[model samples]
Target: MADSLNCSSGNCSSAQEAFGLSEGHFALVKAAVLGCIFLLASFSNLFLLHALWKRRNRRTRTQLFLLHLCLADLVVAFFQVLPQFSIEITHRFKGSDLVCRAVKYLQVVGMFASTYMIVAMTIDRYHAVCKPMVSFFRGSFRRYVAISAAWLISLAFSAPQMFIFSLQEVEKKVFDCWATFIEPWGGRIYITWITLSVFVLPALILMYCQIKICAGIY
Candidate 1:
């Protein structure tokens, strides 16, 4: 994500000229910043995944949910961030239509799936606290189902990105891949839904849970 932001940081060529930085210098700066981000995120997620893997036998369903969360984040870091990092280093986004679509698809799916995983975690907590007698969440099978559904749902929501983006030439024989949604209102509606699902729905759910807990305590 940081890599994407940096590469798409307001006209790269213009920025270099204004700042008097060479392509190599810009690439180096990008490498340093993106390298740090990827290193920290990848290592941390890997460590967590490893720890969880070792304790797999002892893990509860919640632990599995957390495990899925980490996996989702790792997916985003790898697909969304890593590809952009490579682009910055190469100074272009030269790839086939299939690769461009796949990269963008995974990036969007991973992002939304990560948030959905968190929402799943929150729902589990809500159930545990508010409806203690419901023993429906103990099975590992349910965790598998939930995680699968999260990815599927996210993929459904993010499918538009695949068609909305195509590789466009940015420099001589060099290309940059970005979303060029043909339907402006369609894009706006999709973005609005994404915002609601990722931000509003989760906030409302968490808030409701908090209110329930407060009421119970009172």
Candidate 2:
């Protein structure tokens, strides 16, 4: 039992190592905490999705973007985060190359999709308030196009991770499934670009739009 509770290798293990707790105690605690989080996230996302779908009749621009955001978060929670919890508990990845790549791809796609949805929301609000000449991007067709474009863009950005990561066995010990950079600094550069594009750029745009909105209101 004590052996079972000991830190296996990755995140939970690291925490236990840091806290100086016995493997059994901390492992159960980690498992319980993670299990609760998974359940709460799953239920909350499902409810949000259900609520969004129920309000489909209203289908405003904001609603559409929010629906997509909920879907993206649901995908991340189920396809990426849940599977990751299992890996964190075990402290190793033993899935096939296809499985690994698919999971990693979905993870990246979900992240980018969520980020782009926020950007879409920001742009929509900005255009509706500031550039009324451009119109609020109404109609079902335009909304579908916007959604399709967001997914396509997310897919294009996430595709590189699919190709870069493969199941590489290290020293016949642990199987670590992570992105393999071809160049020395390739991974760092990729992450930095992703961070900037998905987070920083959208944040800046949101801030600019907020300022414009304030100015317009005042």
Candidate 3:
């Protein structure tokens, strides 16, 4: 019985060591992946933006949306992915409270902008296909309005992130950028709201528009 207990303890210690090692490896992999994503997104978006600019005179409404989408994606690549990559490499956020809050705010801004831009583009397509006459008459005005609304909404919605996140001491002196919520309920409600806004609502809108588009096509 004593021998068996000793063997079990030894095995547990070994398993813990293995787990720690694997976690370190995972962190490196995550950093590498994020770096690749940032690079690819930046390069591709910039190239596309330049191409679009060259054809500015002949661009369509869809192309305009795409141009803004690329801008939003570049924001994600710079503010979101690049910061995350740096955090992964450093193993923690290395910034002041204001910097942390700004990063968090811009991160969500990019997400919101990207999501709503897609929604706007899809709705534009829906209008073009299903309500061609209406689209033709009001397309220019509505296109500008949709793009502006998407950006304004993104900025407004992301404001909370700036207030919620700040640099805090996680250890004796080691600080990290963390979000402070009002215990359990705050976290849950905030997450639910984010999910609904960023994923669920947009998904539903996209789905509805796509269905209508298909029906119109048929």
Candidate 4:
């Protein structure tokens, strides 16, 4: 029985070691793959931005909104993508607490901005169809306003992430960076609100507009 126990212990130890090795290997692979993807995406967005800028005088409202969205995505990809890639490559948390907070902020802001842009686009489409007499749709100012509002709303929503995220050093002395609101119950409430505000509300709005548009056409 003692011999059998010794054999089981050895096997468990070996398994753990293998798991750790696999984790490290996976992390490295993730870093490489994500790095390439982000690099390409960032450059592509930059080129698009440049092209749009060169033709700014001739830009339409829809085009302007799209350019803003592309710009936001590019910034997020440029700033946060490399950091995430580094985290995956090292697999050993060496980043500072400040950077961890920044990462969380970037992630949230990116998402908020992107979603807002989509919402703005939906609203723009609704306006174009529902209020065909509105000459503003043909003008570029409406798009500029939408782009500005999208950024403002994104910043407001992302403000919470800056306060929520933190860095903790575990028993193994490795730093784990994560975002968690300090308030337990409030955090849940906040998440619920965010879900409704960012997702459910927008989805309902889009659906309503789409249905109305379709019915109008019919």
Candidate 5:
């Protein structure tokens, strides 16, 4: 029995060591991948923006949407990917309460803007293909309205992040930005709302628009 216990303990220690090593390797790989993404997204989007600016006078509705989409993607790269890369390297958020709140707010705003902007563009395409006369009559007005609504909704929806996240002391002196929620139900409710608004609803809208566009074409 003594020998068996010793053997089990040794196996457990080895397993833990292997797990720790693998986790470290994963972190390194993740940081590298995020760094590459940040660089590529920033450079490509900036170049595209410059190209668009040079042709701004002759921009079409679709081109305008693409420009806004590129801007949203840049926000994601800076606010979401860059911050995550920093966290992976440092293993903690390094900032004051205001900075933490601002970062969290902008992160969700980027996600919301990127998603809803794509949805808006898809809906615009749907209108052009499926309802040509209406699209032609009010195209510019509707385009501006849709784009403005997407941005406004993004900003409003992300407001909760500002209140939910703050800098807090995790240990005696070690601080980190963390979210606080009421016990038991708060987190579940918040996550559910986000999933529905950000993913499920947008996905459904896109799928419906795509089907209508295809039917109109065929």
Candidate 6:
């Protein structure tokens, strides 16, 4: 009788696992956290975007590059929030495979574009301070060229995601979202390079430019 009871309990546990996030309470909590993050990011980015957008006619080379950066950030925030919103309502992932891929792509593209644009902005500031008389720095056309280069470079950087992403099922047979090939070691390498190129290098360059500009002003 005990063997039969154990087998019956196992069946009951399996059935419970199969249901996957079928209840609303836990989903609501997740949704609340996700929504707060999205709203905060989106609202902050929207203000930046608005400032850039409102000054459309004052399109200096620097302003134009900033505008694109703001736009890219806005797009990312908008797309990033959708899945969170949907999951809140359904309490389970109801998206198609294509939707998942598209969301991932948007997230990657947004992050890539933002990183590269910040880099471009640093280089622009560098040129403005260090080579003020150069024709390339003087013209608005160069701003467009810089923005284009940022976009292209960002796309190249994120190209690996296309091959690396895959949908997987958890032990409970629930679908889980992840990038399959991006292990911790790979992430460390990527982060190291990204930190050096995007944050540290650009920040140093920007600081140099700011100091030069301030010196010149004084």
At residue 79, what lDDT does model 2 achieve?
74
The digit string of per-residue lDDT tens for model 5 on 12-65 reads: 245446566564565676689899999999999999999999999999998999
Candidate 6 residue runs with Cα over 4 Å from true position: 1-30, 43-54, 81-93, 135-138, 182-201, 204-218
Q: Which 10 consecutive residues of model 1 have the lowest summed lDDT?
A: 1-10
TM-score for each of the candidates: 0.81, 0.81, 0.88, 0.78, 0.88, 0.67
Task: Tell me the TM-score of model 4.
Answer: 0.78
Q: What is the lDDT of residue 99 in candidate 2?
A: 89
Q: After superposition, how far is residue 99 of candidate 5 from its true place, in Å?
A: 0.3
Q: Considering only N, C-alpha and C atoms within 3 Å, which residue pairs clash in candidate 1?
A: none
In model 3, the runs with Cα more than 4 Å from the true position are 1-21
Q: Report lDDT per candidate.
A: 0.75, 0.73, 0.85, 0.70, 0.85, 0.63
TM-score of 1: 0.81
Local accuracy of candidate 1 as per-residue lDDT tens digits, 1-218: 22232246335676678778877887778767887888888999999999999999899877788798888889888998888788777766758978988998898888888888877776666666666666364634555766788888888988877777777766687677766644546556666777897789868977887788666567
What ranking emerges by TM-score with the best candidate at the front? 3, 5, 2, 1, 4, 6
**Which candidate leads the pack in TM-score?**
3
lDDT of 2 at 97: 85
Residue 83 lDDT, candidate 4, scale 0-100 = 62
99-156 per-residue lDDT for model 6 (tens digits)? 6666666666777788778767766766666677773645455666778988887777
Residues 62-149, model 3: lDDT tens digits = 7999999999999999999999888777878888888989998999999999999999999999999999999999999999999999
Runs off by more than 4 Å, candidate 4:
1-21, 135-141, 181-194
Error of 1 at 108 (Å): 1.1
